[model samples]
Target: MTYLPLPQPRTTPVRVMTIAGSDSGGGAGIQADMRTFALLGVHGLVAVTAVTVQNSMGVKGFHEIPLDVIAGQIDAVASDIGVQAAKTGMLASSAIIDTVAGAWRQQGLAGAVPLVVDPVCASMHGDPLLHPSALNSLKEQLFPLATVVTPNLDEVRLIVDVEVVDDASQRDAARALHALGPQWVLVKGGHLRTSSRAPDLLFDGTEFREFDAPRIDTGHDHGAGDTLAAAVASALAHGYTVPDAVAFGKRWVTECLRAAYPLGQGHGPVSALFRLNE
Candidate 1:
């Protein structure tokens, strides 16, 4: 016999859902989340909250989708498709946050799904993405339901009601924010001025874990946060603990930033597809 045929086993895909906005540039928001999931070998799903007309320069404008439609999309996915992990981002308004939180509760997927909340309060280009009212709504409606809330310095200020200037301040802010009911809180220090490293602090309602990486000097980075959040979710979906997820996620984003390709005239995007050859 020249050869024999053998049956190959099928592998189940890791399911991940991202509830966020759509970036017209295809560099951030829903697109970035989906891309990150794909790069990490996970099946991606999305429930868009808004549509933004933005580019590397900045956000020109945005339109929030109807709350009902947002709810329908979330429920439709959670009910049928199902997900191993879920992430929330760019909640354009209080209404959207309220709707998503309500769905999570009513659908009883609260503790079942590993929820990562990337509290995207505003864009790095000084464009206000979330309204003032949405801040209160986020705390009341979404914070309590999150498995982990990832907030940058600016966002941590809003969430914890304190200014984060350094690592110590980040620890304090993390503790205060954890009081709001998130199982764990991660304070991203990318906005802080440091020598040559980007540091992120994670407070797991107990001890603090600091994640550090040699900063990649590049302005062509837009979807970095979304990528980090998605990568963390993917790791968690694969049964990695929170600390391990953060460590691996940071390494992943560092590589992404290091391999970023210039796109527009202004701020570009991190390379989510950098590991393709590997």
Candidate 2:
């Protein structure tokens, strides 16, 4: 009997990297990023900048990884695995942020690969993730190199030094962030209580677009922002435009939130594998 040859895989999986913290709870940061990447059909690489002793209740403590190690991780991934796109989250300190920025430039990933900056300043429980002193460095060193910057309402306030109380103020914040040099800015209005719709504003210097979803009235969305930012990077790696990627990310996060389940004692996490269960 003659045996037929097996089919070979033709396309290489898109590789995307996450330079962020590791959540011991497996909800956000590197865990969330890797989950999102896999769900979106991309290979996920991680350059852990910090490790958090966090649970669904809150972040108890964190340890920032050394700058050299952080740089080495990025170098290893970019030199060999080769990142198609990347995202930054929970960069703990100014030193790590600086190291990451330097590595990005040194590895020639600035314009070669799309970078999504999730300026994660605080946790869902209002615990500060980034040091106060590191804010300036993050905006100065990383924002300019970012292809897109994704900030929630609280993060927008922290980065732009303005209160986003209304739709007009949200627009102002997006424009202000765009001035910092990211090609695009996504101002997530998930925390807006007055509005029935969760309106997220996207601005690209010249034009503004809005993406809205019905607010999921659940408190189980612990890692929603990280998941959304990771999804955007994954979409970018899969060859979607910035606007389209953001839209896709928003939709995916909405699904995750809608399918969220109870985890620990407090705020739980959105289900990254919700699509699989469905």
Best by TM-score: 2
lDDT of 1: 0.86
Model 2: lDDT of residue 166: 87
State how far residue 238 of model 2 sits from its true place (Å).
1.3
lDDT for each of the candidates? 0.86, 0.90
lDDT of 1 at 49: 93
Candidate 2 residue-wise lDDT, 1-278, digit = tens: 11112223676678889999999999899998888787666778999999999999999999999899999999998999799999999998999899999999999999889999999999999999999999999899999999999999888888989788889999999889999999999999999888999999999999999999999989899889999999888888877899989888888899889988888898888887876664
RMSD of 2: 5.0
Distance (Å) between predicted and true CA of 154, model 1?
A: 1.2
Supply the TM-score for candidate 2.
0.95
